[model samples]
Target: MTEVTVLGAGIAGLAAALALRDRGVSVEIVEQAERLTEVGAGLQIAPNGTRVLRALGIDPPGPESRAVHLIDGPTGRSLIRMPLGPGFHLVHRADLIEALAARLGDIPLHLGRPVAGVSDGGRRLDFSNGQTRAVRRLIGADGARGASRHFVAPDHAARWTGQVAWRALVPVAGWPAEAQVHVGPGRHLVLYPLRDGRLLNVVAVEERAEWVAEGWSQEDDPQALRDAFANYAGPVREVLSRVERVHLWGLMDHGAVPAWRRGACTLIGDAAHPTLPFLAQGANLALEDAWTLAAAGDPAAWEAARRGRVTRALATAQANARNYHLTGMRRALGHGALRAVGAVAPRAMLRRYDWLYGHDVTV
Candidate 1:
C-alpha cells in the first residue's frame, strides 16, 4: 500500500508527490485526465517558489524576468518599472509540469481515473467509473472543483467577481524579458514573453455584468477579446490584433477555505485557496505548500504554519485586482503617485514585496 495518495496530477499534486518521495515517503498520484498535461499559458515563479524548485533539484525552466513594467493602456505611457531580483522566472505551464513529472521516477501514477467523491472519513475515494479505492492517507491537490477540496472544506461557494479574463499566446520575437501590465479604466492586460521569447502570453481582464462560466477550457471569440481592449494603444493593440484563439474564464473569489485539513485528508494549492491572477502567486504558493507539507511531517501542523502566509498572499492578490482597474480621479491619482515613486524611489516599490519574494520555505 502506498503511504500517501495525492489527487489530481497538476503542479500541486506532482510537486507534493516528488517532495514526499524525496523525503523517503512512499507517494502515489491519481489523476482524472488520462495523460498528465498542463493546459495553460505562462506563469511567474517568484523567488519563494524558485527556492522550493531548487531544493527539489529542478531549476526553473524559462528566461529570468528582469522587471515588471506598469503602463497606462490608453496613452501607452510607462508608469513604473520595478526591477526583479534573482530567481524570478517566466515559465510555460506545460514545461514546468513536464519537469515535475520527470522527477517522479518509479512513483505510482494512476491516470484516467475520475474521482466522484470521498467517503469513509476521507479514506475511500469513489470514482465516477463505478469503482472505489481505499487509501491510507490523502493529499488534496486536485484543484478548486476537485473532490478533495469539496471533502476537506465543504459548503464553501465561490461567488463570481463580475470580472472575466481572456488568455492567449501570441508568437513574438526579441521581446524584452519583462512582464508588462497595461492598466486602463475597469480593465487591465498583462503581457510577458515565455518559452525562450517564442510566445508572448496575454491575459486581459475586464469587468463585465455578463456572467461567464469559471474554468480555463471555455473558448471565447478572439474578436470579443479585441473589442474589450479596443481602446488600448501601442503594443497592446498590436498584440491583441494577432490573437486568433483565446480562452475565457470568469474570475471567482473562493475566499480562503475554512479548513485545509480534515480527517486523513488535507488541501493544498487551489484546493485550499483559489487566488486571482493579479498577484501571480498561485503557483508559487502551491510550490511552497508542497515543500512545507512534506517537510513538516504533520498535515494539521503544516496547515497552521501555512495559514497566515497563504491568507496574506490571497488578500494582496485581491487588492491588486481592485487597484489595477481604477478609473477617473482614482486612476489619475494612483498613476501619478506610482509615477512619482518610480522617478524618486523605484526600488522601494519592489522592496514592498520583500516578505513575499524573499520567503524561503525550503529553509
Candidate 2:
C-alpha cells in the first residue's frame, strides 16, 4: 500500500487527502492547529472549483449568487451586472470548511502537530513533538508559509500590492439575492447574503501606501471600517454599522515559483501558487491544485498540467486589482463601459469569463 502524508489540514490539504484516498492511496494529514476550524468571512467556489468538490462527494450547501453587481459607491448605480450561471456559488468560509471536513472520513488526521522540517527529498519530516516520520510520498498543502514549502523552494520573492482588505459578516433580513461590489476612487466594498439568506457577508478594501501585516487573524475596529467608507451609500453604511467585528489583512502579489517538486514530494494550493485575493480564487485555485496533483500521478506531470492554468489565473487576479481601484477619467470610463454592457447585452459580457467558470479540473 502507498502511504502519503499531507501537511496542513486546510481546504487544500483536506481535498488532497480525499483525492489521494479515492485513488487507493493511504493519506495522513498533519495540521498544526488544535482544532479543525476556519477563519475569514465568505468565499466563492466558482463552478471551476466546485467541480473538484462535487467529484470528491463534497457539495458546499451555500447559496449561489445569480449576478455580480459592480456599482458606484455613492449612488449605488449599477455599473455592470454580470449574470451568473450555476457555477458562481457564494459560501461562508466555515460552512464550506465543515462540508470538506465531513467528507474526509477515516483519513488519519494529526492535530497540533506542526512540522519542523523535511529532509531526504521530502520523504521524511520532523514534527514539533520531536518525532520523525518516513513516508512514501508527501504533499505540501500546508500553505504559502508552511514548513513543507521551504523544503521545496527555500527562497521566494514577494511584493506588497499596496492594498489592504477587511472582512465582516453582518446580519440581514433581506438584501438583494446577488453579489454586489461598490467601487470608488481607491476602494471597493463587496456584500452578499449567505447561509440561506440569514447573514450578510461583507468585504471592503482600500489601497494603502504601505503594507499591513501578512496574516488574516489581525482584527480591526469596526469604526475604522465605517470611517474608511463613510461617504458610501446606505446599503454599505448599514452593513458596516451592523458589523461588530472585522478582520484585516494585507494584499500581496507573489508570482509563480518555478519549482514546487522534489523527488517523492510536491506542493499544492497556496504552497504552490500564492497570489493576491483580488480574483477571489485563493480557495478555488487550491482545490484545483489538489485534484490535479493527486490525479496526474507524477510531480512533473502535475506541474505541467497545472502551470498554464494557474499562471493565467494569477494574471487575471492582478488585472482585477487595478481595474477595481481605477480613479479619475479611467474610473469613469470603465464604469461607463460596464454600465453600457449591462444595459445593452449582459450575457455577452459574462461570456468573457466562461473560460474561467467553465473550467473542470476534477478529472
Model 2, 1-363: lDDT tens digits are 348899888889998999999999888898988887767678888899989999999776687789988889977777888888886788888777778888888998889888888888798888878998887888998888888788888887678888899988888886766888898988998888888888888888898897798776899999989999999888788778889989898877768777888777798888888867778899999998888888988879789877998999899988887888888899888888888888999888778777788988764
Clashing residue pairs, candidate 1? Answer: none
Model 2: colliding residue pairs: none
Best by TM-score: 1
Count of clashing pairs, candidate 1 = 0
Q: Write the per-residue lDDT of candidate 1 for residues 1-363, one digit (tens) a residue.
A: 889999989889999999999999999999999886768999999999999999999999898999999999999999999888899999999999999998999999999999999888889899998899999999999998989989876799998999999999999998899999999998999999998899999999999998899998999999999998888896888999999999999999998899988888989999999899999999999999999999998987888889999999999999999899899999999999999999988778889899999889988
Which segments of model 1 are wrong by more than 4 Å? Answer: none
How many clashing pairs per prediction, in order?
0, 0
